[model samples]
Target chain A: MMSGSGDPAGLDATTLNCHELGLSFGGHKVLNGFSVTFAGAGITAVVGPNGAGKTTLFNVITGFIQPDSGECFLGDKQLTGRRPHSIARLGIGRTFQDVRFIARLSVIDNLLLASNAVSGPTGIGLRAFLSEKRIREEHSDRCAEVLETIGLTQKAGDTASTLSFGQQKLLSIGCCLMNPRKYYLLDEPFAGVHPELVVTITETLKKMSKSSEVIFIEHDFEIIEKIAERVVAIHQGHLIVDGPPDQVFDTDSVLEAFVG
Target chain B: MEYVLHILMLIVIYSVLAYSLDFIVGHGGLVSLAQAGFFGIGAYAAALLSLKFGLSLPTVFLASICLTALMSLFVSVPSFYLQDDYFVVVTFCFQMIVFSIFNNWLEVTRGALGIPGIPLPVLFGWEISSKSEFIVLGLLILAFSALCIWGLTRGAFGRILHGLREDEVYTESLGWNVRAVKIIAFAVSAVLAGLAGSLYGFYVAYIDPTYFTVMESILILSIVIVGGAGSFAGPVIGASVLVLMPEALRFIGFTPSLAGNMRELVYGLLLVLILLFRPQGIAGKYDFTQSKGAR
Candidate 1:
């Protein structure tokens, strides 16, 4: 566990810190020496072009893909090589770029499944069933609340596959509400969504950022401009710019890299 | 009539097998090819206990379930790290290994000759010798299995498995241990298959290495696929169709060998047609697109 370093740039008590992370697939280097410090409560947008390793960053941070080297910390806990579920249990939630959902299950069931992890016991067995009857009621209530917040209450009973692309993305976010983490890694949340839903998502992220830290990867500079307090720019697996949104946007080298 | 009772018994037993596979292949999206191995382990365990040790049927059946559960740990541990074709290959190897044991362990299993004279199920000191009594026993077992399946799919455990089947990465991100859930699902599936095997051994009163071959595993897989994989009624429908098809073929007036070959051809044709035209099967709302990799 690494915590409470007095340096101003150090990670906060409820933040995620990655140091010297590296990864390679087959013979290609996807990430190398990637390091960033996310604070406790703000939106840190990972703005980059396609193939910039943004999703890779999320995968590494969430423990889906182990880095060749370097360590990650959530709060005081060292989460270098932990399993994804363990990282999630430590209060880190994530959404995929492709918007993965249990398509056969209803929207409500998807949220209910997520809620079970937070509301139910940790282990699998008779204990999970015997805990109490009230837990079920609590789970249903929480699922309803999240669905309403995402404006998906009307489609709660519908299968997730039947929802519009924008609604599906919102449902994906709502699924994470069952166990709201202190850190969120949202991978291209607005990739294919409509402009109206974009505003709704931005507002939702703003509200989420008030209580938790958000590390999102977005291609849309407009959305980045509206939501990002800080932006880290990557080009071809290398970090080129990192600072305030306007400052990074103003850099001549970043503009050149984007154009070239 | 006795033959009809025997077929009904097999339907009940195979229904359990098909439903159990539904969990791994249907819900977890792991297409295991080792179910017959677990099934054989149950049958042989019961057969060995009854013939050699003269144990009662109920005691032997319970012991058979425990044995298969322990065997499941061996496959489940390795399966946690493998997926898709590799997982299928490993399970295929396991099925071969179980079959080999059945054929080579002469002292215990009597090799291919198998163990015979297994006592019929006796409940409350009444031997179920008559066909009606056996049918009653089979129906009761089917009812209990149906209850178990219903309880599992409706509960929190089933929800987690469904999530894993749909999108394992998303499930993992939601704080669910994907591997552990998969292992549990596999184990439960094995336990049910083992129960079916135990019942099968007692009902047939004969056990042999030939009964637990890879072809048998394929037959079980076909039943799951043709009936609909994830739905509760899928296995029952699939098992009934598969079990009754061969019997219905008796009226074709072909030689025994030709009839057997035709039955196999029909099974193959049905499987291919289902895969091509209706991958969802009869009752399934979800297609095979939610397979393990899709997750």
Candidate 2:
């Protein structure tokens, strides 16, 4: 098994840990008993070739898919069998690789969809209706703050579909930033982005990692080195290398599999 | 004057139904064919309560809402396990089942014989029997329903529904209990639809299963589609156009036999034209064909 020996339980109690995770479709195994513990905070990039199960790993972690057999833990909480919304309520924010957002809605409304307290039945009744304006204003204020952080403050009132691809990507990330959480799973934030916007996003991720765990998937090594303090390299559903960017990127097989 | 008031009253009732349908279809993106079933349930429920129990209009209204809300679960539960066409199929089946009950359950609904002499609604000791008086009552109810829908669509809740429509997976990832939100939206829609049906029963002073058939459901769906899905004014505008268009046809040179067919022909033509010219609807932003991969 091409697995790393990093013991997340031994290191930090708040770290996200997965134990012997295995998942398969028919006879094809996508995640072959993969195991790794993410850093408690800071940006960690999961770099691997296409079809290496990076997205599947994200799916399992975010409760979109249940592993065949294994346990996932975030701190003391068991997240393996929880629903996606339950996982989200536990402070795990997620962004899609496609930058999925309500395009017909304005940028502010899109961000407000992920705003806090809109979860559960509390946001559905007469009481919710009474305070809806206040809540909207509050969320809009926070969205404005997030848009400023992501350099989308000028386009707050603009519809999401009208935004450029890079701006949409930034908006997707800004949505995750609406309510501060302990962990953020950003799937391929740098994909199809320009180099300048990539720098902007990298800086945003760096700032985000200051107080929360920002685990991202990226194919670009340069951006990975700049943004990712820790790197976990996966090949064929197994973690081939896991360490600092300097150590992990220097691995012979990882370098060959990626660049070569 | 009386005829115009009657048409305006009908507009109010249909506007309520259109708004309710829009909540589920336009905002939640669930093309439910079961709305007519809930509407039928409300109508039958109100009619029976009014006839058998001799309850007040307000009591019958409450009962209808509660009953139809519970019935909405029949479709909402299927939504969790099904997607797109399958979800619509399930709703279609539920709609048929409800219509069958209304048609075949002669013991309660009176079947083809139909229920007659449903008394005018008495609100706070005032009988709303006259056309003008009923119009006032319908307007009040319309205003209330409009207010509730406005409240729902203007806040974080509305945004979440839009999110569900846009991408259920993404909305789920954002900590929204997608199933619960959709179920609640369906229930709220059913409640309003039920209220409209109850009002229809009291206003018409009679009702038959024919009034709440799958065809009626299609008409309500058309109102949502023709008006606009997400826009607040879409349903009201759609209801006004559809209800008044047929009446306006009477003023035109067409004979009675040709006019009825002409109204339908015009309706179909208008919908086709709207599809060609403005696929998102007059006030809507969502294009039906463009819903896929739009995230």
Candidate 3:
């Protein structure tokens, strides 16, 4: 594993800055001139109503969809109109609004799949078998570590489809841990999770914040208040407010957007 | 002895085809039904080069791979945008088109008569004229194909392919080039199928449009599904069952025609049972249910 210098400034910080990011579906604009700058590191919660285009923002950042006329930047890398996997390889890892666990695969295998990004494309059959002693040991060790962190060590061998909804959510996060990235884009990580698991997730995010930036979208403001250092509130495809969690929540416009 | 060697050679050739298809359907989650089209292109390329142009074996083989890969690009264009059932339909159309060309294009494909009397592969100065030698050649190709697949699956690229299989949308967010990876995988798989097809054409000493039909594609798919998908041993197991099933049917005291039907029946029965009970097949770690709703 190649370790970079530990200096926070020296480390290439991933900044997802959107300038006039707009997207239209069938002519009606879903996101109209939406813009926000997520800087450095720490958890930045994107809080909004059900249809505020939060997930769509994550999509545009990750290059899943093209913006009509705007730009997205990851650190110094201009990420506009690139492929999603290429964006992911550029140090951005994202979860889904719907937990996208490979339902047929074992939980550990799912994690192993994520870990492949670190190893690259040469690790398949015979070579994997020939180097099995060391590779398997490393994979097992890492998988054990992440699974234990997510409290899913016991369910490592279980098929993903067989797990409870909360466990499945944890496993999805666990998969992301196999390959450590600079930026994490989590879509509703707290959804369907139990209270205890939610605490575990919050702690995991807190730990992750020290080394990497986390931008997560969530409806539960309580959880957001617990983990988020900053919040960006969106309303109908626009950034209505951006600041620390307390101030953003106390704003009259945010209250009106939610209430009215 | 010659007949045995021929059968063995065919097995090795089909094993490569089956392995290539496994990458698309098994790992990439694209149940492509166009292996036969690519296979036909390979056979036609090799046959044309050797029979008409009088090219060497190695040259023919390389040309076959290139031609098949080029044709695969067309399949990839539409299939890349679609997934699962829609992708299958696109590939199926390509298969039909390839077959039609082979059957109707009299000037080039000989109108299904199949260029006959293909000579045995010859090295620099050595002529590999015997059937056993041909079997050895086929086995070597099969070994190479297996190694390639094994290497691919264990690498980062292979994992990305699996991730695409799991959830392509999520995979995109991980900074992986989903479209590029899909196209590369599809093209590589087509090349492998082409190699197998070229080898099969040479070993059989005859070529015909009927051999490259949709049924042939189904047989290759069945081999992958029955053995298992997404595992190294799956294709090997699938190929062995397909090869041996017919031999096993001979003990049932039926005529050759009846035996053929019985063998196919058995194959279908086995596939159905596996899909019903063990949807993941023998060595597969993941079940088919994931692919069921993946679109």
Q: Considering every candidate listed, which one attains the maximal TM-score?
A: 2
Candidate 3 versus the native: TM-score? Answer: 0.85
User: After superposing the true interface residues, what Cα RMSD does each candidate give?
Assistant: 3.2, 2.7, 4.8
Report candidate 2's interface RMSD in Å.
2.7
Candidate 1, residues B1-295: lDDT per residue as tens digits?
8787788887888888998788788766778889998989888887878777878877887798778878888788887787678988999999999999999999999998988888777777989888778777767777877777777776677778778777777777888877778767778889888888887888789999999999999999888898898888998999999999887887778788898999999999988898899998877645774454342
lDDT, candidate 2, equals 0.83
The sequence of per-residue lDDT tens digits that candidate 2 reaches over residues A129-177 is: 4456687766666877798889988999998889989999999899888
List the candidate 2 regions with Cα displacement exceeding 4 Å: A1-13, A117-132, B253-258, B292-295
- Index of the highest-DockQ prediction: 2
* Fnat for each model: 0.55, 0.61, 0.42
Candidate 2 chain B worst ten-residue window by lDDT: B286-295
| Chain B: TM-scores of all predictions | 0.95, 0.96, 0.95
Rank order by DockQ, top first?
2, 1, 3
Model 3 over residues A154-255: C-alpha lDDT tens digits?
888887879888888887787777777887889999987889889889888887778788889988888888889888888988888888889989999999
> Please, what are the lDDT tens digits per residue for candidate 2 over residues B116-168?
98877899899988988878888887888888788887766777777788788
Report clashes for each candidate as comma-separated counts. Answer: 0, 0, 22
Tens-digit lDDT track for model 1 on A1-260? 22222333445558677777788888788887777777767888887777778889889888888999777887568887788888888888889988877877889878877776654345343533432244467677777777777888899889887889999899888887667789878888998899898888888788778888888898788889888888888876677788888999999867876776
Tens digit of per-residue lDDT, candidate 3, span B1-295: 7766766766777789888999888888888889998888888887888888878888888898778778888888896588778888998999999999999999988886878887766666567777787777778888888988887776556766777887777665554556767777888899999988888877777899998999889999998898898888888888877887787678667889999888878889998899999988877754676544242
Clash pairs for candidate 2 = none
Residue ranges of candidate 1 with Cα displaced over 4 Å = A1-12, A119-136, A236-238, B289-295
